[model samples]
Target: MNPDIYKLLIIDDHPIVAEGIAAIASRQKNITCKSITCLKDLLSVIASEQFDMCITDLEFPDTNGFQFIHILQDKLPSCKILIYTMHEEPWVIARLSELNISGAVSKHTDTSELSTAITSIRMGNKYFSEVFATLNKRKSTTEGHKIPELSKREKEVLSYLAEGLSTSQIAALLCLSSNTIQTYRKRLMEKLNAKNVAELVSKGKEIF
Candidate 1:
């Protein structure tokens, strides 16, 4: 591969969707694209290869798409992730920066925009549709309630939780037992008044 060319991986459960993006995105200068149908296939590829970007959809049936994005970020820390999904909820938009995602474009956008997004991210800039900015603004305005201050330990837990680590994974990373991680998660949830992980990350990302 040419050093000047960027490689983008399209990950959508539907082979056709992935291929369509790959085909269109491949036309851009200094860019190439390959598509995968599922995360399992991606795991197989990740062990031996890396790419410039991973374009993913958030509606996988067999996996929670947010968690999957976290996994991709973990596995490919240098690769920018571009969400190419139909989901545009406020929670999703606010959590994008929290998750360290580099860029995003709604699937409903023109196919040419995909090329534009890829080009922008390849140049080390981010590309999100107006929808994300609008949603993020709304989240900041309407969900302006503040939470209590957290201890240093609680803040640590929230950061890892935002990264999408499971209880056991966080425990192992923190060198504590799983039970301790669970306790921290519980306390973080209570502090934030979050009923679930999604809510926890969404609210906590703003604070962190």
Candidate 2:
């Protein structure tokens, strides 16, 4: 066991996913992964061990996700929390932010993104997916880059984008066609001087 290794605990209801994630994470430099599939198992193991970070999903069989968070915070306050679940609604993101969870990534994202998230959080920087980052913007500006003002419709689309919605998803929610949403996205990117959708989000957060 390397003394400099980072111990990362993976808490999820599905044992297979937890184990898979642990295996992938173990390949990172000096990081060891541990999986806990149930709350019952966690209670016993937590008392005897300490971790540098914890990645948890908000769903579990024995207890609510919120309860699990409370327990994790109470029992291991020093451990940074990384959210790895599909629940990325505005309310859910906001609640996790209030709880001081350090980072989040969509389940739909690639396995490679998991390594990025871990690295970001390990460096004391918050990690969030494009949409999550848009919604969870912390600093007021990105190097004093002045954000161009947007129209009401554009703002509406931006709001939905911040909530982590896809173009089709936003179109459905707004009762507009996907083409119209695409138009809005293009207009937004051009107006904001963003080269691509990813940069659109990266820059939009400065204003959002």
Candidate 3:
């Protein structure tokens, strides 16, 4: 591969994960990673900059799931869009295809797989994890499978809860009334069939 020919963008909200990807890619002789979190900022930068490929998370603090790919493909039709997410649902795979994503990778996977995904997308090939490929499409057997259908807000609340936020604190951060936050908590528990906070935390880790 030509060292000067490839540039990559990583769009994930987690600072640590983004930095980790940069660190790994920096060690490679022919690849580099630029990290950013916001979609608008990404689009603005991309307009002025050229990237060979993009690896983005399916979720973000400011956007719907994986919708950034649509905007990115519009702006840079030649750039490869790889979806790096913890979501292992078969429907997600179908959805990525519909959006013309270049690849999909699971966060729980090894770093080598990610590096391969980058190279594959850069080479105009699609990548999919073996585990994700083997998962049953008709009935998800993954943990937290029972809680598959989460509202966007519910998914955000669950992530924060796993981060150790109290319901009141989460309510304040989300700008919702305490009662509304409580309602979200209740609904999350019911949907996931969680027995308690501890179980909810455990389950959250499995899915994300």
Which scores greater on TM-score, model 2 or model 3?
3
TM-score of each: 0.67, 0.62, 0.64
Worst 10 residues of 2 by lDDT: 138-147
**Per-residue C-alpha lDDT of model 2 across residues 62-129, encoded as one tens digit per residue:** 55466667788899898888888886554455456557778888888887888789988888888888
Q: For this target, which candidate reaches the highest TM-score against the unseen true structure?
A: 1
Per-residue C-alpha lDDT of model 3 across residues 1-208, encoded as one tens digit per residue = 3557578888888989999888866776677678888877887887788787888887665654455777788888887887788977654554554467777789999998988877676667888777566653433455433335677898889988888999899999999988888777766664454668889878767666
Whole-structure CA lDDT of model 2: 0.77
- In model 2, which runs have C-alpha deviations exceeding 4 angstroms? 1-3, 137-208
Count: clashes, candidate 1: 0
Which residue pairs in candidate 2 collide?
Answer: none
Better of 1 and 3 by lDDT: 1
Ranking 1 against 3 by TM-score, winner: 1
Candidate ranking under TM-score, highest first, comes to: 1, 3, 2
lDDT by residue (tens digit), candidate 1, 76-143: 88889888888775556655646788888987878888888888888889988778767767767875
